[model samples]
Target: MNIEWFLVLSALLFTVGLIGVIVRRNPVVILLCLELMLSAGALALLAFSRMLGNQDGQVFVLIVLVVAACEVVVGLGLVVAMYRRRLPLDVDEMKELKG
Candidate 1:
């Protein structure tokens, strides 16, 4: 379809993810929102790649997928550790990771 349609969809997906990240308190929810944002970025990349008839976009999408998978693994491990320690799933508490 039209490139504009693809970009609009991607923008909408990113917006929803941004809202989720801002409005949700739970760490898991935040991670999922971040995933959504990543997915949107990948989608846009693929769409543009297809529009331009290049293989590079598809390669970038594959890299994004690997990164997203790694992100989920690390993010879920942290969340599970927090739960095991009887901590609330609050994303704000993650500030302790700053050090």
Candidate 2:
């Protein structure tokens, strides 16, 4: 596997995820996009690790996965809380926290 191709693929995924995060209005959609970005990052890291025969990249990917898991748990909790408060999933509808 050519390292440059892996890098390019990762860049493309990251760009798409960025667009999703910026263009979407729903909180859930943003979270899913964020996950996509993270996955692309992890894939790039894994590729580099394999190419270089280093364990550090894989370790970093593992750490990222753990963090992403935590984010999902907390993010879903927030979504549930929002629904309980009669809040729409749309980001523009959230105004209770504003001072």
What candidate 1 gets wrong by more than 4 Å, as runs, is 93-98
Error of 1 at 32 (Å): 0.7
Model 2, span 38-63: residue lDDT tens = 99999899889999999999999999
Positional deviation of 30 in candidate 2, in angstroms? 0.5
List model 1 lDDT by residue over 1-99, tens digit each: 799998999999999999999999988888999999999999999899999999999999999999999999999998888789887677676665676
Clashes (candidate 1): 0
Stretch of 10 with least lDDT, candidate 1:
90-99
Error of 1 at 54 (Å): 0.3
The C-alpha lDDT values of all candidates are 0.91, 0.92
> Of the candidates shown, which would achieve the greatest lDDT relative to the real structure?
2
lDDT value, candidate 1, whole model:
0.91
Q: RMSD for all candidates, in order, please.
A: 1.4, 1.2
